[model samples]
Target: MDRFVFAGRTCVITGAASGIGAALALHLARREALLFLVDRDAGGLARVAAQAKAAGARDVATEVVDLADGGDRLDLAAAVEARFGGTDLLINNAGVTLSGSFEQVSMDDYDWLMEINLRAVVRTTKAFLPQLLARPGAHLVNLSSLFGLVAPPRQVAYATSKFAVRGFSEALRHELAGRQVGVTVVHPGGVRTNIATSARLSGPDLDGQQAAAAKAFSEKALTMPPEEAARQIVAAVESRKPRLVISKEAKAGDLLARLIPGHYWNVIARVLPKGL
Candidate 1:
């Protein structure tokens, strides 16, 4: 297939209020794509929509909806359909992180994370699939994580959700092949984002050590700018790349996982920065 074009194409992106999602909205806006941006932060979404319009988006729409809620997701899909009639690109970028070991995190917390991260991705895809199928060369992008490629200690819940996303995207890619819909699953390393500071701590850490560790990890490991990550993602989408792993750290993790599927964590743990 030829390179996917964004000009005048209707695109829907979740979590467009901040981080990589915000960056993506700007990039696509510059490409003159019609934009539908969704996030729970009404203020942030409005800001992005204004910027997108100024950046040369052919059209811009904003929706403030909590992706974790099925009703919200449904309403978002309906609004997109009503406004744009259909969508050419659907990027499921909304996600949250939880910090704790399996024993420390409660089931409620785990479920909440899954609802926004994995379940929402699946539901959103299902909701927009008809439109994507109708549009030639349509694409789907799912934001997984480096942890999705390799599991580690204390990240049981997060790793589970990301791995599930990776698996779901891969399987759906196969199913959609020869049907014109392209799927791209992204595993980003530590792009500078609020995800770290905003991550929920499952259980009480009386000494406040867990919170401190999260801060340290955010400062030390989140090296890539969100703009750079967004640039790579947009390029991959244009090229119809099926899988993208951003950052040197993510590449190394992917390599290690392939080489030592069972014991990569032993080596990773040693090299991982302290306090995380």
Candidate 2:
């Protein structure tokens, strides 16, 4: 498939304040795409908007909407409809991570992460589907994680949410193929995001060691740059690829999952770093 042109295309990206979302906004702006950026962090959103404008975005709109709330997501969609009529691309990039085993993580933390990662994706996508359908050559991108493909020791809540996203993206892709809309499920390995520092650590070792370990794991194992991940995501959307794995580690994990199926835990336990 030919690369889909972003010039004059309307793109809405949730969680546009930082990390992969911010990088995607900048990259898409450079491509001359009209951008609607949304995030709960008003300050971070402003900074990204300024950078996007400076990067050559002709039309940029930003909103401080928390996707965790269904009402906020609907309002965001209304705002998009009011400003640009509709969007050609919807990137579901906002998500949170919880650090701990299933037993260690609290039910409240699990619910909170699930609300942001899975429920928000569903709500936001549903809110924008009408607009996407009206536009020609629309694309949907959902961000899953490498953990989604292969579960490790910790991160039970995060993995569960990502696994759900992966399933949703797959089913939606098949359902939308005949409707002129494409879906791409992204599995990013690490990509230097603040999710580590901001993650809720819930273990007995919460004296700060768990948080530090997560940061270290992200820095060492998840080394892909956010900008690079954004570029690849855009490319995948353009090419209409069904699945896009961002890093070498992510690719390896996917392969391992496919080969091992029900036994990847054993392999991962042996291969993963001792501290993590």
TM-score of each: 0.97, 0.95
Model 1: ten consecutive residues of lowest lDDT: 68-77
Question: What is every candidate's alpha-carbon RMSD to the true fold?
Answer: 1.1, 1.5
Looking at model 2, how many pairs of residues clash? 0
Give me the runs in candidate 1 sitting further than 4 Å from their true place: none
Give candidate 2 misplaced runs (Cα > 4 Å).
1-3, 203-206
Candidate 2, residue 106: how far the Cα is off, in Å: 1.6
lDDT of 1 by residue, 5-88 (tens): 999999999999999999999999999999999999999999999999999999999988887775535667778889988899
**Clash tally, candidates in order:** 0, 0
Output the lDDT of residue 74, model 2: 71
